[model samples]
Target: MKRALVLFNQALRWHDNLLLSEHAYFDQLIAVVVLDPAEYLTEQYGIKRASAQRLQAQLKLLLDWQQQWQQKQLVLHLRIGDTTSCLLQLAQQYQAQSLIAAEPTAPEQYQQLKSTGLALRLYDINSLLQHQLRPDLASLPKSFSAFRKQREPELLVQRPLQLKFSGQFYGETKLALDTVSADFISRYHTPTAALLNEAAALERLTKFIWQQRAVLHYKQSRDALDGDWNSSLWCFYLANGSLSPCYAWQQVVDFEQQQMANESTYWIRFELLWREYFRWQMRQHNSAWFSKNAFRPPLDFSAPIPDKRFELWCKGQTGLPLVDANIQMLLHTGWMSNRGRQNVASYLIFELQQDWRLGAAFFEQHLLDYDCASNWCNWAYIAGVGNSGARQFNLIKQALTHDPHGDFVRHWLPEKTTAGALVHWPEAKVQLQDFWLPFLKQLKSKA
Candidate 1:
């Protein structure tokens, strides 16, 4: 009997999953998910690769998938250890002829899959644009506009695949739950906002586009620091592969066709293209994408020995109300607005003069919707080391423009006595004068 081991990493959903749908012909198939311990261990950056909150969110996704598959009389083996070793051992025990998985954009993940040295069938279902139709990496555009111009005319998003199984699938094994802890499983089994399955993802997409008609005002309110309908909030689902980009793209196309076609509708697709651009950029630059300079020539920049400033920035004690408020929001909740991200990134790189990678690492640890390519590439863009070069935002100007009434700042940072624009410039207040004076003097001296 032919048997196959299917590995589920980021692509956790059953729908639009080419890895499982295309392999339905196998007589017997065993699905496995391995949780790599290294992801929870602290790295040289003094932070865990995945924070407790992020792990909690991920476990929730896994549990949701496990329950759904069990309804179909199929078991999803959950293991904890080195990814490649676990997959190989499982394949050997199951006597599977081949391993199947979704193609990974991250270089490290690609290397891990290749190291297994087993017969592997990979599918490119994670991205909106299929791998075969993507531009040659050697000549890929260096800017988002150039990339969009070249691909928009010929944009093709395949219909999401529907999986139907007619073969004998493996049942729960003795070793299925041996490696994982009951407490760990039970902790996330209870419901919370982070638990998002494929069904939840689809419901949210419909609500945003059709029910509330929030897509019409997305361009205007997307910059708000905190709101439910301001942005699509699809990143959390897309980041974990619970929702397919192609599926999301098609939904927008249908919305325009049946409802209305405006700049707001067009901007939704534009953002998706930006995501595609970063993924390809990461593929093209590989390790250079994570380097200190990031696809640019080396500079004489060095992080402080102790990095106390970074610590202050992370803890929301920067004395800059707008920046501190944004940091607090991220710490309290694993979300941040796109405009907030740009301002805080500019503050870290241009105002604070700290290493951009440190800020990127901090976000990786905290962001629930973190995509490595988008996170790192954006930081590089603000630091002037990325494809589009440097982008510096005036924190004062940004705060005044976006949060003119200081509502967002006051909501997150309630300790401040200053009101209106004074909240953004704490140095202007006599009581808080000493708090931000040093930073202002430092900036002046640097100038």
Candidate 2:
């Protein structure tokens, strides 16, 4: 009898998963996700690889999947420890011919999979138009615009495959919720529990496309720091494997046909292209993508580190109203709007003058929708040390534009009830020129 062992790296859902689809060809199939202790350990940035909020969200998703597989008379095994060894042991016990999984974007995950001494069949579960636009990784344009220009014409979001499984599989093991931290799920306020499963992802997809019809005004309101209708908010599921990008695109297409298609509708697809770009960047660069100087001009290695300032920024006590508010929201909910992310990331890299990687690490730890490629590459972009030129946001200007009435600030910081324009902005501790001047001088001299 043929048996298969599939590892749930990032693609955690059964729907639209290529690895799970192969279940039909195997007699007995076992699905497992290993909670490697190494991931929970602290990194060089002095932050845990994941925060309580992220851990809690993941745990809830696993639990839901466990109950789901259990009802189908199959076990969704949750193992803990060295991932490679765990999977190998499971393979030996199950007598599986080969291990299989969706390819992982993060360097660490790719490394772990390589370490596993098994015949592996990995599928690209992340991208949508892989077959249509298979650009050589080495030849991927450094600029997103260039990449988009070439691929946009051929952008074809494939229909998500509907796999038919026997609904019969071997193995039985209860989920080990205690293996992950309990702090993430307890006592903290989150957006909603609906964010943790494929069913919820589909629910959100319907609401965004039908009930709210929010795509009609996405471009106009995407900049708003708050509100549900302003953005699709699908990244939460996209970051996790519960929702496939193709599925999201399919829904977008349906929305366009059912409703009026406009620039707003196209903008959603534009954002997806950006996501794809980052994934390609990671695939090309691998672990090197996380280095301090990955794709841009080298930084002056003599600069002093700002540990205390970075800490303040991370804790949302930086005394900058807009930055603090965004950080506070992320700390509480493990989420922040894309606009909020750009502003805060700029503040940390340029204003506070902290290492960009440190900021990336913090986001990786906290954000519920964190994608390793997007998180790190965006940080590198804002720091002007990676793809494209340096881009810095004037915090005051951003507040005036996006949160003019300071409503977003007040919403998070209730203590600032008597808010005037940027009232929550404390007196500046570090003047803009302190960092800005050196950056300008370097760029000017280079020019």
TM-score, every prediction: 0.90, 0.89
**Runs off by more than 4 Å, candidate 2:** 23-26, 166-168, 172-195, 296-305, 422-425, 428-447
> Considering only N, C-alpha and C atoms within 3 Å, which residue pairs clash in candidate 1?
none
Q: Which ten contiguous residues of candidate 1 have the minimum total lDDT? A: 426-435
The alpha-carbon lDDT assigned to residue 316 of candidate 1 equals 90
lDDT of 2 by residue, 172-271 (tens): 5543233332343344325454346888888888898788888889999999998978998888888878889988888888888887899999999999
**What TM-score does structure 2 among the candidates reach?**
0.89
User: By TM-score, how accurate is candidate 1?
Assistant: 0.90
lDDT string for model 1 (344-402, tens) is 99888877778888888889889998887888888888888868778888676677678
The deviation in Å at residue 410 for candidate 2 is 1.3
